[model samples]
Target: MATQTANALRFLSMDTVQAANSGHPGAPMGMADIADVLWREFLRHNPKNPKFANRDRF
Candidate 1:
């Protein structure tokens, strides 16, 4: 599970930087765990259905 998330994060970071054509993807790419924790833990959401209108997407 953790490995899958890590790989997904790498692809996401790379894609985002590639799309924007600016900023540093490397930093976020390296700090995926911290990003994951902040988003998956501290951030608010509806666990049952995160896509629900009232929930924050990220």
Candidate 2:
């Protein structure tokens, strides 16, 4: 699951940058695994009410 998310993020970054003909996509591509893990496991959110005053969004 994590590997797939990482690969997907990398592919999206590369594709978007390539299409735009600008920006450095390589770093994001390389860091996707770490980013995915953090976001998927450690990052907190309240999707039902994202703007809730007490939501631990950070």
lDDT of 2 by residue, 1-29 (tens): 99899999999999999999999997999
Q: Model 1, which residues run further than 4 Å from truth?
A: 37-44, 49-58
* Winner by TM-score: 2
What lDDT would each prediction earn against the true structure?
0.79, 0.86
Going through the candidates in the order shown, the clash numbers are: 0, 0
lDDT of 1 at 28: 74
Position 47, candidate 1: lDDT: 70
The TM-score of candidate 2 is 0.77
lDDT of 1 by residue, 1-58 (tens): 6667877898998999999998888887888877677776787787788687766666
